[model samples]
Target: MSEVKKIATRDSYGNALVELAEKYDDLVVLDADLAAATKTGVLKKAYPDLHIDCGIAECNMMVVAAGMSTCGFVPFASTFAMFAAGRAFEQVRNSIGYPHMNVKIGATHAGISVGEDGASHQCNEDIALMRTIPGMVILNPADDVEAKAAVHAAYKHDGPVYLRFGRLAVPVINDHADYKFEIGKAVTLREGTDVTLIATGLPVSNTLEAAEMLAAEGISAEVINMHTIKPIDKDAILASAKKTKKIITIEEHSVLGGLGGAVSEVVAETNAASVHRIGIEDVFGESGPAVELLKKYGLDAEGIYKKVKSFI
Candidate 1:
């Protein structure tokens, strides 16, 4: 077995920004007094002139990023998911999404993975809120490699993008040289015929582990990394549905309107597969260890395995 590397997606985002700053001279970063937590402080350290600390005002930080975008500056705004997707939603909707500004919103510490921060900080509805915005592209990278690629992708793509990152240190899954990441396209991690496990963010690694466990028990479970949420790859979902005939969607988000909801919409339109969504129920998260919260919410590998077995 190859050595597994564990890294927080927020750390990957910070490193990617530092590299991106070298290529794009117009790149600017804005943080809402949470640069250390969000990891945007890396950019601030390297390129202090291009980074702005907008106090603790998330709403104003978003608008400021939007204003900078008008001047041909590609601004990557960093903050917790709670504020970026919840508090500054109006500014994001009106200033960025509505006008189609070229700004990338880096939402870190998203979902139950935020752990001890409790319900107030845990953002289970960010994906849902961002999906409601017109012409907004949502990217949820699974691991370090993909997170770095996503940052570059978001920078190249012209428009409003919400890039979701996590605080937990997840294992590096897509470390091979041939693993390519295309926005809005799903990547099949493991091929199988019995069932399909579609997941995004940190839960993707858990789903892959569940697939391994399922394989040992005479079940061939296909695993897919649906990194992009909005502008989701409907074709991939349908194709996997045709082969597996049964699907299970998992995420670190609410089961209501995250990856599961997006996959359900596609499956309902073109396939007859029975889809089971594994994620946080329609409830607020409580303070606990990140791993403990995942298990309690049935988003862990074991929890996903159990749910998938029953569903299949």
Candidate 2:
């Protein structure tokens, strides 16, 4: 077997912004004293005129980005997920979401993968909070390839967008010769008739590995990457549920109102199927190694395989 390549989605986001700045002169990047950690410093280095560090105030950063958007400038705000979604949420809703400002929020270090940051830094409720605000588009890209595409897609969009990214490096899964990304459309990586695995963010690669493990045990599993959490691919999900008869949704977020909750709402209305949610079970994450935390919370490939195996 060949060695797997890994890259952080935050790094990809930073690189994509620089690439986009070359094409769009109206593009501007902003951060709240976390340019180094969020990797937005790459944009600052490449184009200092297009980047700004707003001290340590996340709320003020949102206001500045919103103010720039009204002047025909596309602003991409970068910061930790906790600060972006938890601390400056009202500004995002009032200043941006209310008027539908074209401010793209690149929220990095999301979920329990923020290692030593503990529960206070980890943001597991961002999806749930963003979902409540009307006209807010939420995106959680799976890998570096998808993250790059998502940045471009969000740039073209005309309203508020929240792009969720992680701190840990993950394996590249979309290196196929004919890979393409479409906003609001789910990508089916594998085809099967027994059950369907619907996942977003880092869990996508793990779901694919679980599908491979299930195949060896005489079980055929289908995998779907639901990257756009807000405008979820309902057609793909319902079609898969009708064929597979069973479905499992995975994410690195709380099961209350994350990907699993969004999926269950669709499954319950359109096609009823037994759905199992694999993620943090309404609890806070503690400080530990990223991989170890995944295992303890049953978010790894082995844990996913076991859950699907028992469910089936």
Task: Indicate the worst ten consecutive residues by lDDT in candidate 1.
Answer: 265-274
Per-model RMSD to reference: 0.9, 0.8
In terms of lDDT, the best-performing candidate is: 1
For model 2, the local distance difference test gives: 0.94
Candidate 2: stretches off by over 4 Å: none
Report clashes for each candidate as comma-separated counts. 0, 0
Candidate 2 lDDT, tens digit per residue, 1-312? 988999999999999999999999899999999999999999999999999999899999999999999999999998999999999999999999998999999999999999888999989999998988889889999999999999999999989999999999999988777988887899999999999999999999999998999999999999999999988889999999999999999999999999999999999897568899998898988999999999888889999999999999
Worst 10 residues of 2 by lDDT: 267-276
C-alpha lDDT of residue 33 in model 2: 99
